[model samples]
Target: MRLDKFLKVSRLIKRRTLAKEVCDQGRVSVNGKPAKAGTNVAVGDEISIRFGQKTVTARVEAIRESVKKEDAGQMFTIVKEEPTVEEEQASSNL
Candidate 1:
């Protein structure tokens, strides 16, 4: 499955176009390597996405054309989520 499609269908990014834009800007990576919107994804592939102040890493569990909202979370397993250096520092000082 395409990275952008998978991101949208899994509700990771909410929209396919946004996923493509994020990928194009190099905010998305697969298996530790930067990935493009058209990148192919398979089960077990680890995907990491940068979202402003935080980064979310998830492992692909399944690839489907479509899934219900309630089933979306089953598509990937969140490995970890951490704030960016700046965010972490700011929070630490609070």
Candidate 2:
């Protein structure tokens, strides 16, 4: 499935257009490389999204067109976040 569609179907970004916009601006990556809206996404792929104040990483567990809200938690698993530049360096210097 397309990355944009997967983000929406998985309830990651909420809207497809927003996903496309964020992707076009290079705020999204798949498997550690930058990805575009049309990028193909499959199971087990890692997806990272950057928002203004936060970054979210999730590993794709399954792809589905529609899923119940109660079952949305089964779609993907959240991974450890990348520490901000300052925090990372600070920790390393500790």
Candidate 3:
């Protein structure tokens, strides 16, 4: 499966074009290495996406040409989510 397609089908980015844009800008990584929009993705591959000051990492759980909304979450497992240091510090101080 292509990285961009997987991101959209899994509801990670909402749209394939957005996924492709992000990937092209080097904001997406697979298995710790930067990946392109058309990079091949398979089950168990770690995908990390940067969204501004936050980074979300997930493991590919399954791949399908299409998925229902309810089943989209089943496509990947969130391994970790790191927020900006400012956000973390603010939360801790609250």
Candidate 4:
């Protein structure tokens, strides 16, 4: 599956255009290498995405043309999630 499509289908970015933009800006990587919006992805591939101060890493579990919202999360397994600096600061105040 294309990286952008996979991102959309997996509900990672919510929109295809945004996922492309993110990829064009070099904010996403596949298997530790920079990937383009049209990059090919396969099962078990590691995808790392940067969202401002936070970084999320997920392993591709399944690829489907269409999936229900309830099953979206099942398409990939989150390997790691690095909290944003602001979130960490807020938590420390508690």
Maximum-TM-score candidate = 1
Question: What is residue 15's positional error in candidate 3, in angstroms?
Answer: 0.7
RMSD of 2: 2.8
Scored against the true structure, residue 78 in model 3 reaches a CA lDDT of 99
lDDT score for candidate 3 against the true structure? 0.95
Question: Top model by lDDT, which number?
Answer: 1
Summarize candidate 3's per-residue lDDT along 1-94 as a digit string, tens digits: 9999999999999999999999999999999999999999999999999897799999999999988999999999999999966678888998
Summarize candidate 2's per-residue lDDT along 16-88 as a digit string, tens digits.
9999999999999999999999999999999999876467899999989898878877889999676656566
Pairs in steric clash, model 4: none
Could you tell me the TM-score of candidate 3? 0.88
The global C-alpha lDDT for each of the candidates, from Candidate 1 onward, is 0.98, 0.89, 0.95, 0.96
Off by over 4 Å in 3: 84-94
Off by over 4 Å in 1: 89-94
lDDT of 1: 0.98
lDDT of 2: 0.89
Worst 10 residues of 1 by lDDT: 82-91
Query: How does residue 59 of candidate 2 score in lDDT?
Result: 98
Note each model's CA RMSD in angstroms: 1.6, 2.8, 2.7, 3.1
After the best TM-score superposition of candidate 4, give how far the Cα of residue 90 lies from its true spot, in angstroms. 14
